[model samples]
Structure formats: structure tokens, C-alpha cells
Target: MGISNILEPIQIGSMTLRNRVLMGSMHVGFEKLEDGVERLAAFYAERARGEVGLIVTGGAAVCQEGGMGDQYCNVYMDEHIEPLRVITAAVHEAEGKIALQLFHAGRYTNQDATGVESVAPSALQAPINRHKPREMNATDIERTIQSFADGAVRAKKAGFDAVEIMGSEGYLINQFLSPVTNKREDEWGGDFTRRARFGVEVSKRVRAAVGPDFPVIFRMSGLDLVPDSTTMEETLQFAVLIEQAGVSALNVGIGWHESKVPTIAMMVPRGAYVWVAQQVKEAVKIPVIASNRINDLRQAEAIIQEGRSDMVSMARPLLADSQIVRKSREGLFDEVNTCIACNQACLDHIFDGKIASCMVNPVVGREKEWALIPAEVSKKVAVVGAGPAGLEAARVLAERGHQVVIFEKQNQVGGQLNYARQVPGKEEFNETLRYYRAQLDKLGVEVRLETAATADSLSDEGFEEVVVATGVIPRRPEIPGVDLPHVVSYDRVFEKQAKVGRRVAIVGAGGIACDLSHLLVQDQVVSPQSAQYLLEYRILDAKAVHHLQQSGRKVYMLRRGKHVGTGLGKTTRWAVLANLKRHGVEMVTQIDYKEITAEGVIIRNQEEEQLVQADTVIIAAGATSNDSLYHALQGSLPVHLIGGAKEAGELDAKRAIYEGAAVGRAI
Candidate 1:
């Protein structure tokens, strides 16, 4: 097995996979109704056809009360067995095996939605999961164990090849395993071995119910990633006992629901939990499955080839692109709708009770409803600027049979989007760029680089429609000291202007400031030569709560008012605050910056006057649109201004893609 080699056949109990890829469990809100058999079957079947070796159906609650997490979760009812059969049959038809990961929402289930009392191993409730949980009586515990065993039997009857017991996440089983949540002194708590008793018993009952050949995957968090929760070391030791109880495989996961920086899910890195998986893999001979932000095929292959884990699994990746397996096989990898891990549509919208849709692929859940077979229209069009808006506009127009011409002033296609990929944590921005590049290429759209479109430079275009997607520029504040030698912005840092000193202070709290913080934390800051392209950002909310502030880096979030970071999205805001809080970055909120100098910044916070030191000053105040071209060309045609130019909307992929679609349809 070499590093360049691909994943080979692997065995997990009786069922074997031709490759080591499992279409990880991602609920597209497929079970909104009582019977989600057909919808779920169709969804899994699509991925199977795309060549996935294994399909783990989005979690099915083993019990009705205190079990389900969302409004659309599949139930473990006897009737649900019939639907499970349908899904298993569909996957088998496409030569893919299916596994049922039986789950119990435990305290994570919403009490408001269910109107049921949350039951846990103990009465201690999670701060974020604010449900008044009733301590599990002996009868409740016994019933839960029996219910899990029953669900495994039902899954077997439904034709699922295997069943994985859900112990990962901070669910019922994990809650019992966690010292933070479980405070019981009785049979199920106190000691580490005693704490793991519930999960161990559930596996024992499940194995007994399903018989000897049936493989049971024990899904447990490699690390809870929550304060005072179980770590990977605990998980490793916990696995040894669970394996002794007849577990066939271990499904390694990271973080709990409340954890903003999920161990495996975000923009952290590819295969972030491989080490955790490797640890368990080395300890166990039964094989281990690793899952967390594994989007790259090469990474997955390397994991298997290097024995990091027996297999790799993904949830959101399969939803964003059902044809990922087939596309990868056919070498159309870039064309696959990449999961940017933006929880906006998938988690946020679904929690809000809407269907799961991708920001890039609008036809995610409604793929059957909105699909174009591609028509050959013959209109010639010119798209200005090859940024997200322009790239998307040109791609869609060309797909509709229009002969499109896209012009970008920069050598690269992704304008500010390209620069954003260089920012830490926001690496998902790179995927958005790949999506557009692939989309435009497949549509046969002609992209012209280094072609800056002006009023006079509108040559090679005598078409029916012309789109001015030239994008926007940054706005400089009228403050007098902004023109100083040391003042710079995020754009300059991204462009990599040299001669910037080590210690830096970035001003601002919005997306620009957050990104600069990540960059400055990574030792990338603005220089004097590149100061023209930077932003002068100040903060609005500067309360550090995470360990990111411990990075030994100096970050002073300067604000003129009472609040900072008011513009960040809910989930994104939490992540930024968490990182900033952990890294020991000095935050100076509620301060008015009177001046910027080479040595430091002069500020005013309340009645006190203080000077903050910094070798380089990065500004992130905001951006201004160079919409002069849009105004000049507005009357020449029925033109539309969109995306950032429309309203300083950043490279928020949703805003850009959704707005681009509207512009295309309008045109």
C-alpha cells in the first residue's frame, strides 16, 4: 500500500465494500413526513448509482420520545421498517450496501418541538442544549437499552446490511459517558468504566438481537471537544471495553452539537481526525472508520493506504453532490458540487424546518424539480469581471445556449474570492472558486483574463445581452491618519506585500477583520507598499471566550462604539469569537481610534486614553464599490447590479450564487 494508492476492498463484519468510502449520514430533512421511505430511498439510490461502496442512512431515532433530534428524523417505528427496506433495496439495486446508524437524541432533542420531557443519564443539562432533562429512572434506562436492541433487529429485518450503534456526539450514550453531563452515583455513573456501562450494555443487547455475523459499528466521539468532556484518550480506552462487548468496528467522530469548531466537520483541514482514528485503529483489529471534513479523494486514499483508518465517511459532501463517486471515477471531480461546510442552508435552514439545499447547488433536495438538460441557444453575451457574480452569470447564460464571453482584469478568475481562500478557516472559499471554474468550463464559456472592461473596451461583443459583473473596490475612511506609512488592510496582506514587521494589530470585527485575524495569527500581515489595497477595520463586539487568544499573538479589536462584530452571521460569529477567545488576542472594544501611527494606534475607550502598540496596522473597516462602470453602462442596456456591488455583500457564496441566479433569470 503506497500513499498514492486508492482505497481497496474492506470488510466490516459479513458485508464487504469494494472501496472504503461511506456516504456519511446527512439528513436532507428527508423524513419530514411520517413515511420518508421513497424520498430517502431515492436519495441514497442516487449516491449508490454514483458509486459509493457504503451508505449510512441519516440517523434514525430508536425511540419516539427523547430520541429524535429534528422535525424530519426517521423514526424507529415498526412502520419505518418498511421504508428502511425500500432504501436498502434501492441501494442494493445500485450495488451499494446500506447500514442503519441507530440513534437517540437524548437531551439534544428539542423539548419545545416534542413536548416530551428530555431523559438523560443524569439531571445535569448542557448549557447550549437547554432542556429540563429528567434523570433516567431504572425502567427508562432498561427500556432504552431494549429499544436499541429492538431497532437493530428491525434494521436487520429492513434488509440493512449492518447497524451502527450511535454513542458518538453528546447524545444519550455519550451523555452517560461524559462526566460533565452525567452526575449520577448509581450503576451508570461516577467511575469511567461505570460511566461507559450504558453504551456497553446497548452494544451487547444489539449484538445479541442481531446474531453473530451482524457487524455493529460503535460510533463514538474521538474527542467531545467540549469543556470537561471525554477526550480522544478516554475514547480509546472506552473503545477497548466496547470492543470486548462485541463491537465489530469503531466509527470515530469529534465534538458535540454545541461545539462550534466541530472535530471533523468545518474548514479546519482535510481528515482532521485521522490521528484519533489512527489511535483507535492501532489499538483494535476489528477496523475503524474515520469521518471529519474529508472532501479530498487523495486525502481519503492516503488515510486508507497509510492505515490511518480502515475507511473514510462523509455526510454533507454526498448531499451537495450525489454523483461524487461517479464523478470522481469519471475524472469530473471539479464538476462535483463541493460542500463548502457552510451550515447556512444545511444546518441553519433545516433547523428552521426548511429542506436542505446547497448554496452552490440549489437543486439539492429538489433535484427532481429543477434540473436543466442543457439547450443550445445562440445568443452572444459578454460578462464583465470573472469573480463569483460574473463567473456564475456567464456560466448559467452559456448553459442556456448563450455564447458567453467573460472578462477578468486579474490573471486569476476568482477576484476577491481567490484572495479569501488564502485566509485561514475560510479555506472553503477555494471550493466555491472551483465550482465556478468547473461550471463555466462545462458550459463552454470563453473566459478572457487580464481584460479590464471599460466603456471604450467593449469590443468582441455584438450580442443580445451584456452583463456588467465588474465587481466593487474597497472604501477608505476619511480619517486623516489612514494615509500614514504603517496603515494597511486585509487585501494587501492577501496580496503578500513585503516589509511588514512581526507584531500586528488589525482593526475591525466583521468578516474582513475575522479573516485578517486568522491571517495575522498565521503571520500574514500588510506592508507599506500594499497599504493602498487594505481596509481600516474597527471592532463592535470584542469579548474573547475561546482559547484562540492564547496564540501569543497581539490582536487589539478597536471599536468606536459599544458593540463590535454585529455584522457576522450567527454560526460564523461563534467560530470567530471562539478562536479569538482561545488565542489570547488582546481585545480593546468600545474604543474610538483617534489616529494610526507607525509605532501604534491612538485610541479613546470611555473616559480613558490609551495607545496600543503594533509593528503593522491592518484595517478592516469595510469595502466600497467602484460602481462607476455599472452606472456608466446602466443606460446602454437593461443592466442589473448584483452581489457585492449591489450592497457590499462579501464573498458569502449564498449571496453571490443566489443573486447570480436571479440576475441570469432576469436577463
Candidate 2:
């Protein structure tokens, strides 16, 4: 329907939000030991200016022992209150409400990072972190409860509108609630009431400490999403008890650190866990917020309109475009840069102990540094290659009131992005390309298709500035028999220029290799004509569908590294590997390539040398910078190199887009 429901104001306890959109808490690792306060204040202030209903600061550790170990904000003591006030004040100045999420990492925390023994309800080693936690005694339990209350008091003193008790995602409260982690036989475990006691008590204590008037939001896991974890029914029961115990609202999230279910990856469907929030909404009278993979305005609005949730929470979408709410409110949906949930930067960066950034939006965490300002004098700019980098540079330069033109050698824009979209489960990359295209049209950036750019031609055209985003070329490893007709690059396969045989051997273990393997093993029986005529018309039977999904191709992924898909994001690696396994794609790692024969490629490992039987060999070994034009045009014009032309280290879109934007802004 319409987005009126999402734009409508919502109330929780004594606080009234401007809209139903909440910037869900995400760990960005932006906290500093000395001057951390102002950095975070500026970060949230930008989002606040975007007019989000409420901004939930990334989880702030409630106690030193419960800290997340990395660069996380602390709200455990009175000293933290003054520094945190900076964030609350800045958000308030922008007429936005701010909430502090008080968290205890429990078994999910790393002992090496914290330099303290992690504590949980039971002495169990968490599967994901592999951290052995000390079972909480009576004193430790009391202290933990007090820590939550103390954090709440500090939050209130710091001028926070509310305090969200971190109860979900295998945190301290979730650990006690889940049967898989809470294997205790004390008053805090063994039974449903006892197991949920920690969460209930924390909510009650926080509510008491902050007074009955202040809002106390309990972030609950509607379902633990792991084996032997709390079920929907049990979680719903716990929700009821927590509401009665004094929770003003519930922020529902899915899965945990060890959850097998795909939660935030690109493969996960939007609003996949909204049903969990729906069930929780039905069970509790408090406002329910649904989160995880809620990427666009349509999806967020639908969640609220369909009576699934009272509000929608998103972290990645806002990270990609902080103006999501503002833009959507103005009916500028297409202008909004949607999050594709690639997790290439946000979640992956957090896992790698770096500040989280966005793949599509490069100016996420470094908003202050990458702030867009109008140019003093507009100039004619020529950008070579219409890939993500070139397109971004053109868009930014045009936005700065400069005349910009992008020259692409191919018939279409989106350099490798076009090939990227053809890969299985990567159709979302098209959305990013769409954003660039829209921005180009809106900003009046002239695009010339099938036109190769040179410094001589640009100088003849009277272009004042030039940017080279020539992108990359596939790096074919030098080996014997590589000149065979069957040996093709990944680009040929993606462009449908290469005909692959029943048996395929990929010569790389990066993301492209894995994606190619997935593409090769996909069901080949379902033709586009049949899919449109039969499946689209609902004329296909279950047997026919099953037949359409049968694949006869045998694929092998070979790598010199220890692991396949090593270049993949942490959140997506396991899932991609699992898909490869289910499709029976043989992964051969740590292999020394010998030579390619007429039949197959010969390889050597530690034990022996053998031939891998294959009819077609695909070289996805990697890409080298396509900088020949840049090198040739170096002294002719004031040319700035960007994207793959500048560096082809990891083939990361984040770096490409950011570099493009940076160069655009600088010139």
C-alpha cells in the first residue's frame, strides 16, 4: 500500500518517536579510549540529521568484565556518563531520540581481547568464539544484574531517551534463556521461569533504576535460531513474562553468533524473520520492532502495514544510505541507495576488528571526513570506464555542479558489475548499478556507450579533468596448454561467450571462482521459455520442477591457498561453501598446478601429482589492473587513477566506490 503507516509516529512508554523507523544498534568499532566521545557524537549526529525515528547506539558494555573486548563504548560507570552525554546531546540537537543499548557479551566475547575470564550462566565453550566462559556463581549473578541497573542509571543521567537491555544474539541474557547454553540446575536455570529469570530481572532492575516513567527496551531473540535453542513458543512466553516484569518495548532480532540460519547475508530474503517478530507482537502488548535484512522502504513499510510489527529497525540499510527515511518520506525511493546485504564491509569489518563501513555507501563510518561540499568552480570532467568507480566519480562530480561525462567501451554501463549480477545469489548487485544509473541521469552526467577514451581524444574534446577507472582484466596464469580453446576466463563464461562442457575446472578459490562453480552446477533443464510459459503460469508440476533442478555438470574449484572462498566475507563464506558441498562441487586446495593437458589439468599436492579430469578449464586466478590507458595518458593530461586501475588487490567494490567518490570530491 502506502508508506503512511511507517511515517506515522509511534510511542513507547513516555517517549514518542518521529516515525516508525529505528536505526538498529550495530557494532561499528568507532569508540576511542581518549577522544572517543566526539567521534561517536558526530557519527550519530549525521544519522540523526537524516530524521530517523530513533537511533540506537552500538552496544555499550555494562561492566568491565562484560565488555565486548574490542573498541566498544562503555556505560558501566559514572565516568562514562559525561562522555556519552555528547552523543545524546548531539542527537537531541537534531530533534532525534537516542537510546543506549547496555550489553554483556557473555560467551560470545573473546578472552584474548578482553583480558578477563568471560562469564556465562554455565561453564560452556561457545562454538563461534571458542571462548570458555566461567559459570556465574550467586555473587556473579547479583553483580551482573546490578551492572545492568547501573548502566541504565548512567544512561538516564547522560540524557538518553531510553536504554535497551541487550538480551538477544547469544549475549548474557540470551545465554541464560537458551537451553543450549544454560545447562545449570540453579534458581537461574533448569526450568522456563528460571532460565528467563536473568532477562526479566535485568529489565525490572533497569526499569526500577531509571524509574517507571523512562522507557526500558529489551532486545529479545524471537528465536535463538540454533539447535536445542529456545523455540518461538518459549521465547513468546519469555516475552510475556518480561513485559510483565517492566519492559516498555521489545526489539526483536533473529539468530546468534552460532546460528546456522542465514540472518543478514544477501542470500537471505527481506523480512525473512518478520514472522518471528509477528509472533512476538501477538504475544506482547508492547511495541515490537522487526529487524534483519529490512533493506528498502517497500519492505519496511510492508512489515508495518501488514500488521507484522509496530516498527521496523535497520542498520545496514541506513549505513548504505542514512537518508533512507528522509528520502522515502519525500517519495524519492529510487534515489535511496539500498543495502544489498553483502556484508562485505559492515559485518565482515566488525569480525576483522575494524570499524564497520558500507559496500555501496563508502562514507559510512567516516561521515565527517567524506562530507560532500559544493565545488568552488565547476569544470568539465571526463571519466573513463562506466564501472562502479567511474560511475561513482561521475555522480559525485556532477553533484558538485561539474559537467561530467563517462565513456564506456562496452554497450552498457556497470563494468564488472554486469558480470557480477549474472552470478547466482548476486542479483542484488543490479540494485547498486541501478542506483548509479539513476544518480547519473538525475545529475545529468553524460554517458557515452561503446566509446573508448584516450588522453588525446579527451584533450581534443576540451575536457578539463580526467579520471581513469579502467577496472581490471582477468589474470591468466602462465602454464603449458593454457592456449587450449576450452581454457576460458570468467568474463567469457559470465558473458555467455564460452561454452562449458559437462566437467568444469575453475583455477581459483576467490569469490568469483565459488560463484562460477555455483553457476555451473545450477539446474540447466529449465529453459527461460519453459520458465515463463509453464512455471510462471503455474502449469509446472512438482515432478517437473524437480526435473528442472537436476544438474549433470561436475565442477572442481582448485586453489593454492589453504581454504576455498578465502576472499569471501565471514558471514557468507560458510553458506557459500555449504552450497558448493550440497551441489557436490569438489574443492581442491593447496594444490600446485603442473600443466593443462588436452583432457584436463595436471596438479601436484603434498602427496602426489595427478591429473584433474575436465573438459573445460576456467581461469579465475584473479585480476590485474587494466592501467595501460592510464599509463599511456599519464603525462598528457591531469589524470587521476581510481578503482581497479589504481589497485586490484582484493577486487573490493567498497574500495572502488570510496576511491571514486574521494577523487570526485577532491577534483
Candidate 3:
């Protein structure tokens, strides 16, 4: 038996994994057109050194002529072989198996590469992809088949253990499979069988090209999850067909990029798509791999334990903490760097043509060379605030073998985190608090709760270094009736028994404001039992109009600016907007607040002035930096103010923690 039974070996055709840990395919964006192969090799080699059982090299485009995105790697031609050889050879040298996920983004291709003349199963254009595809003809189909075969042959020669066909998410194969998209009258359209023909044939050709010994992993959407999309029956049938078409296994996925929510990290819960994998596994004889939000080790064990799927795949989780596997094996799962799913650091950065960085763990993806543990030096350090920044700094300092003490005015750790965790879907942020607490205990850092430190106090203590992590304060908005007992700040919303009326109105469009809206709404939601587990929904039909809307909610937005919610990231923005729109939240932008009365909110918009009725009004405009402690201690002692004091973002948890880690390493 392997560590916690997670390292057990399984077969994909003749290829056997040393362990079930598969470093799922993720775009590193380090691949330049010229240095692509070398960069990819370096990326894979680093993962291989971490003992990644198998490596899936990002999403490699198969046809340079019609499919490619900016700074993306492509194995589209024989010219791409030698460079890919470097990748496979590097992985193998580290005693790891390497596979390539062959991709053709179709309409998802970039305009700069394909000249905007790309084609999907249908001619429908992506809302943001910007590329209008060239519809595929019989010759296009033939060339696509040849392209898959060519890419597969190159994979075999390059020594990939297998090749995963990128068949999900409204890509070419999925477009044909989807009824909402594929409207062609040709043999490739009309029915499920015909719709699956291209994928099945591509698998057959890829297998034939690579010989029977080489495996082909068919990645497909078991359920499109789109409105008016292909049914589950079609997906199951397609799964069986692909299995019989000589594919080694199926990598199950769900939904399309244009669905209610894309990007598995944001919307999907952990094990959110396990049922998809289970359905495919039950429908076919071949092994099935499950992915999409399966981040925790226990959840993964449950999937295999209950026979839901043969293996689990993780991308962002692995990226955030490459040592997760090793740590879990050693019963140190708490030490792992958890993914907050912010998308700001990882997805957004890489997409923006920068190296992928972690929101909290700044040293991520660079662990092979970059060390968060600074050089050996004995220094006494004092970190004030005991918050994300303080703890991160303390942990890093302790790791670097420095004597460190953290001071907090609060009785417990997690300053803002204690409050920030109040948001919906952000309950996991508490994991960081527990992680730091565990680090404090493990590394023996002295934590003095209720010990507020000043520059003079720290100087009297004779510490070598001082870091003021005393975070920010809520910026109070100037408005009438704000001082009344009926009006409470967002921090107080989740702190105590906030008696919000049936008609609740929240002001401000900041992260906390949006989150406070969700917190209040969820508090009002109802969950009825008809089947398995607990359920939840909103009460009073209140939507975070500024954040999102799933169903109709009577959410009132009082905006002081033009855009209601401008500060949110991509994933959060979509969710917030969709939720708000679905709930029919009322929007009143560019409003001057006249007053907050028991009767809703009275404000004047640029267009017109209106007094909306509200049971209660909550404020979430912005935060004020309570720099009194830092400023008082500033010149008095050598104090470095990092994080929120340096920049403004709620996830300053990330900013603060990274600063702490950097300072810890340096000291």
C-alpha cells in the first residue's frame, strides 16, 4: 500500500503510474515561441523533481495554421518535435512520466494567430474570444484528423507516456457534440453518434499513429451543463464509443467556457464534478480520471474509495503548493499552501503574458530554485498585528532559523481573516489561519496575544528587526443616520446578531460590500431536503446586485460611481454579475445619498432622485488605514510597514503574507 493509499499504481494501457498523483495540465505561460520547448522542459523538470508521477504539458495546440493563442506552446508541426523532446527527456531524467494534452482552441484561437477566421462546430462567436472561425468542410475535417495523428506520432517520438485529446469546453470536439452549437446538416451533425464521430475517429487515428502500446487519454465533457445543450445520454454514449475506439482512458470534465461560470476554480465546489466522472466510469470499461475542484486529499481518497473514479487530477492546487503530495504523505497536509481561487495571481497573470504567481504563496512555481528560507542568520524579530502579514513573516522567519515573536492586540490570530472569512464561498480562507497557527506551534514562534507593541516597546525589547503588519480599518462614509443603532458597518454584520430586516439595503461596491451582501442574502436563503446532504438558498430575495445574481432578488444598489462593481476579478465578476442579473437587483448608480431612513434608502442618481424603502442599511464603501500604531512607531524604531499599509486589496492577505515571507527570508 502506498502513502494513505494515494500512491497506489494503476495502468493506462501498458504505461503504469508509480503513483496516482498526476500533475494535471496547466498553462505556465513561460513558453515563448522560440524558447518554448526549453521553458516547458524546465517547467516539467521542476515538477518531475517534486516527484510528480505524471506531467501533462499545458494545452499544446495541434494546428498552427488555425489554432494558437498568444505565448501558448504548440506541437503543431514536425518542427515542434525536437523541442518537445527536450521536455519529455527532462521529465524522464527525473524518473517521471510525461504526457501531452493536444489542443485546438477552434473559435477560441487568437485573432493575431488565425486572423479571426477560425471555426467551431457552429459559427457562433465567443463574447470575448474575438475570433470568428472559418467553418470546417470535409477537407478541414480530414486535415484535423491528420493533425491529431501527426501530433500523436510526435508525442510517441518525443517519449510522452500518453496524449490527452482536448475534447471538452466548447473546443472543436465539444462544439460538434453540443446541440446548441452544432447545427450542420452534414454527417458530423444532427445526432449524438454523428456528433461524436470526429472525436472517436481522432482517437482511433492517434492510437494507430502511436501504435497500440502507446496510450491515448480522451478528455471530454460528460455533461455540457449549458442551457439547451447535449443531454447526458449523448455524453455517456460518446464515452463508451471513445473507449471502444482504442483510447486508453477518459479524463472527465464539464460545462463550456460560455456557460454560467467557467474556470473550474471559481464556481465549482470541491468534488463538484465527481458525478460526471462516475457517470463516464460506469458507462465504459476503460478507467476514468476525475478532476475539477478536487483539491483536498481526503476528498480525493473518498472518490477512489467509493469507486467514483480511478484517479484524481489537480492543477491550481498543485501549482500553489508543489509539495502538497509529500506533505500529505507525512501527515502534514496542514502545511500545504491552499488556493484561494482569487484568479488574480495565477490565471489572470499568466493570461496577461506574465509568469503565474500565487496570491499567498509568492514562492510558488519557483520552488525549484527560489528559497523562501533565507540564509542562516540569528536575528531577533518582532512582527506586530499577528494577522496574515505578521503570521506569514513569523513563519518564514522561524523557518529561516531566526528567533521571532508575534504581537497581536486581538486575543487570537488572523486579524482581518477572522473577519474576511464572513463572505460566502470564502469559508476556506480560514484554512490559512489554521495553517499559520500550526506553523507557530510547529516552529516554536512566541505568539503573545493581547500584546500590542509600539516602536519604543519593541526597542526596549531589543529586537533586531520590526515589522508593522497592523492592517487597515474600515473607512466610514459621511452620511446622515449612519451613527444610528439601526446602521451598522460591514465588520459588525457577521460579528454579532445583525438584525437585518426583510428589506435590507447595503451600500458600497467594494469586495467587503459585495461579500456582506452575499453573507446577508445567504443568511436569508432557505434549504429544503428532498434528497442528499444539506442545502441552502437566499431569504428575502436579496441579491448582491453589485456582486452577482442567480435568481431574481430585490437587491437595491446605491452606487456613488459609474460601474457598480468595478474592483472584482474575472471569475468573481462573472459570478457577481450573473447572480445579480438573475435576481433582478435594482441599480441606481451615480447616486448622492440624501439619507438612510427606516424606509429603504433615499438617494439622488444623476438621472433622477429617488427614495427607496429599506429595512436596514449596511455600509461597505472602503477601508481606512489605521496607521496610528505604525506612524507612532515609525521613526522611533527601524520599522518596515508592508502589505495593506503598502497597497490596498482585500486579499492583502496575499500581499501581506508574501511580504512577511520575504522579510522572514531576508532576516
Candidate 4:
């Protein structure tokens, strides 16, 4: 597909962006110190340097009553102007346009963080955070609108090119717009027009504050994606109203924090929400920006070409690879590190009060700290194992002018990732592998496949430094009859080295166990590969569907913990659990493995012991470090151990990749 349209310049009010691609607002939770502001400046500046047209900064509170506290940026006070100017200046130096997303968290604000009672349209409690908000009175509403105007003035003075009024994602403006949250019979809540009055008034006030020539983008939810929330028609009506309210453009966002829908997960198809943007675009004369799940340049370009939306907005994709736009323009599209839609590090970290980072791009959130600079002196480096850690280490080292070689025991790269990709709905991991392969090739790194390397061997090869990313070995839990012929490890199952019988019992209830259970309960006759092919081609083969539906195997996922799949990411855990439930995979939690026999396995629950029949037993208890080479090479040469070799408690690609990148830069 031609990307000429995507690369074309677009005008939003008085500001003319370099291109149609915009970096949507996403919270990173950088510290509020002076240094933190500098770091934030570097973060956005990096993307600007990568040639993004316009960058919408993470949401900043507009008032003391709606402050997100110290963890997030706040412009409610006059003191914030200078610090924020640092970011705007840096972005401008890179020749990039920037917008400030003015926000009010409302009931989503944590009282513990803000030290103020949260306020909302009504007294209803937020669904996710469960914070009961005080109903906003007429005076409070007027004050909030003025606060938004004050925020706009501050943004304009801080050198921002534009301002975005955040009215989506269950925030204050969204709360008043939705009938579910606004239950008042007052003028601001009785009808759709009344409920929408708050957002319109904020937009009008902000436009007035910034002047008519300045761009004001109103970000509103297209579906809300929650029960009792505004419908699509209502959202379209909102689009028209906000356009009439003096906003220069519209950014169509999907879902809310309280929505039950999976808006950002891998299971959702790419551009699944473009229709929402198209509806709003058709309803309003102003340009519409589509947000959510736009991972590739072609997809973004196609959206615009098809007239679905005027511009494409991306958040996590930029976090994954800030240079996506630059790469696409340079025709290095294959080199772009596409976001895999794994919310493990970004969203999960934000919820846990940590700065958001990317699983694939380790330098994110640490742009200044991890800035890549050419090494003054390059040397020969040996990276053992070609998993996430080793590959990352090699990539960085090679980029810094070092001659790097990677040794893999297997015929191919991607150590545990090869097995991980076999899990249903995790095909996106293949993109990570592809990225590594392309990076290694581009960097001219030597990769020796089916070549196991020992410390002595690496030393004999005259390597200046060695990195041990030997990865991990799956643990075989000790049980009385674990040595039986039918007992196998999860890896063996994925490798097709073990034959699973009609009835299978999996030991452990983590991600691996859940994945194995899902795999085992499927029809043994039809390979997942074939099933995926049929699904991808949209060929509704009834026999294949029937075979999947009538899985003959009975699989039990046993866990010692109180809950199954406790280690799964919050965003993906529900989907995995639901798949297991649909397949009737039994989950036996808080169980102790007594013994295993040919007939079955004896297990003990809280109250009593029972014999669960199983023809085959698979152990997914976890893994232990394969660090024998690291230990053997400890004193021989300068060696660094990363990934599973450093810590084998859990399978975390995020830590592994980050450590690898860190070591790569260090060496």
C-alpha cells in the first residue's frame, strides 16, 4: 500500500503538522522533580527526533481538585510552567510540534495520592477504582471549567503548539457526558445535551483562553465500551457538538478504564476500531484522528486512504519504536519494531505506580539514561544463547561498533520464545523474532547456530568479553512417581517429544500451566497450525470447528497457590482463563501432589485427598537457570550473566530484554 498520504503534511487549525501521524497521549509517571522534567523532555525529544509529526504529551491535571498528584504531570499551579517549558523547548529544537492533553481524573484520582476528595458529575463510585466521588455542584462545575481555561493559558505560555481537551476514558468530562454516571435532574445531567454541556463548556472556555487560531483537539470516546454508557450514535452526536463547540479537530478514542471490552489486547484485530473514527468523521467536518491498535505504517496509511479517519494516532507503537515514522519514510519498514500489544510492562507498570516502559524497547522511559552512543574503542564480544537476552545484548553491542558473535544451542534463535509463540493467541511473538533477525543481519553480527559454547571455548576463541544468556531449563518437580514414562515436561509437549494421552493432568497453575492445559484440551488430530491457517483465511470449515469444539481430552491444571495463572498479566489473564473455561479444563487449586501412578495421580486438597485419573502427566512448575557455563567461566574472563541465567524465579521477557540491553551498552 502507498504511504504517500501518511507522509503528507496536514493542517490542524493554525498549526501545520509535518505528517498525519500523531503520538497519542499516554501516561509514563515520570517523577515530578526538575531532573524528572528533563527526563520527560528527553523522552518526547527522542520521538520528535525520530520525525513524528505531532506529539500529544501524557495527560496533565488542570486543577488542584483534579490533580493526579506527584506521579503525573500537573499544570494546575503557576509553578509548573517553567518545568513544562523545558519539554516544549526540547521538542521544538527537534522541529516537532507538540500538544498538551489537559485532563481531570475526577473519581479516578486516588485520595491517598491527591489528599483531596475526588469530585465527579454525580455521587456514583468509579467501577475500577471504587472511589466514591462527591457530586459536583453548579459552583464546582463553573470552577472546573475555569480551571480548564487556566490550563489552556498555561499550556500556551509554556510553548505548546496546541491543546487537547481529554474527555474520554471515564475522566471528569466523560463522567458528565455518560448517562450511567450523570444521574442528576439538573440542567447539566437530565438530557444528552445537558450531560454534554460540561465538555462543550470546557472546550469553549479552553478555545477562548488559547484564542481562536490555536488548535483545540477534543478527545472523546467513540463507544465508551461499558454497560450503561453512551452508544455510538450518542458519541457521534458528541462529535458534532464538540466540533460546534470550537474544537479544531477530534481524536476518537475507544473504551474506558472501566470497560469490559479488550480494547488493546492482541486478540483484537488491527484497526478494529477504525469504523468508530469513520462514523465520527462522517458526522463532523473537522478532521478525525483514530486511536487504538494501529501497529503498522501501512495500516495507518490505509485508514487515511480509505477515508476512515484523517489522521492516525498511536501510543504504544511509539513506545515500542519511536523511530517508526522515520523508518517507514526511509523505506526501512521491515526494521521497525512493531508493538506486540503485550500490556505487561506499559499499562501494568502504570497501574503499579511505576513509570511506563516497553517490553521490546528497553530504552523507553530511560531515553536519556540509555541513549546510544558509539563506543570509543570496540572489542570482540561473545554472546552465548540467542534468546531475548542474548539477541538484545548482541544487537546493542554490534550497534556500538563491537564485533559480536552469538552462539545458539538450537538450530534457530529465540530460545524459550520459540515455545512461547506456540501458545494460542501469542503469534505476535513471531514479530519479535523477525525483528531480532533483521537487526542482527543489519548489524552484521555473526550468529553460529547449533553451536554450544563453553567458557573455555569462548576464551580459546580470543573473546575480550563474554555474555552468558544461556537461558533456563524447565524444572521437574520431585514427586514419588514423577520418573514414570508418561510424565513429561511442558517443553517436551511443545517440542512434540512426548506423546500426550487422552487424559492429561498438568502440574502448576502459572502461565505455562494454563497455556499447556489449553493446548492439551484441543483436538489432537488437528494441529494448531492448521487451525490458525483456517481461521486466518476465514475458511469456516465446520469439521475443523467441530473437532475443536469436541476436544476429547480432559485436562486438569493443578496449582499449589490459591489462584490459577496468578503470574499472568492483568490484561491477558481474563482471556486465558476464559479459554480454559470454554474448553472445560479443570482447575484444581491449593492442591498438594501426593504421588503419580499409571492409573492416575493422587492429590490432596484442603479437606481431603483424591485420586485424579490421568493417562499422562505434564509438569509446568517453572524453570531454573542454565548458568553452568557462567559459573565455569566466572574467573576466566569478564563475563556477564543476564535473563533467566541471572534469576530463574519466573519467565519475564521484559527484565531479560532490559538487562540484555543494559549489559550491551555497558560492555
Candidate 3, position 105, lDDT? 77
RMSD each, Å: 6.8, 2.3, 4.1, 2.5
RMSD of 1: 6.8
User: Considering every candidate listed, which one attains the maximal lDDT?
Assistant: 4
TM-score per model over all chains: 0.84, 0.96, 0.90, 0.95
The better candidate by TM-score, 1 or 4, is 4
Quantify all predictions' global Cα lDDT against the true fold.
0.74, 0.88, 0.74, 0.88
User: How do the residues 30-135 of candidate 4 rate in per-residue lDDT, one tens digit apiece?
Assistant: 7554478888898999999899989999999998768778667988889889988999999999999899999998888887788788899989888677578899
For model 4, the stretches where C-alpha displacement exceeds 4 angstroms are 521-552
How many clashes in each candidate? 31, 0, 23, 0
Assess the local accuracy of residue 341 in candidate 1 as a C-alpha lDDT between 0 and 100.
74
Q: Please give, for residues 333-364, the per-residue lDDT of candidate 2 as tens digits.
A: 88889899999888999888887888898887
Q: What is the lDDT of residue 386 in candidate 3?
A: 84
Please list all clashing residue pairs in model 2, or write none if there are none.
none
Give candidate 3 misplaced runs (Cα > 4 Å).
1-4, 32-42, 113-116, 261-263, 350-354, 497-499, 524-555, 580-587, 597-600
Which digits, one per residue and each the tens of the lDDT, describe model 1 over residues 412-472?
Answer: 8987777768766777878778888888878788888987776555533555567776666
Error of 4 at 532 (Å): 12
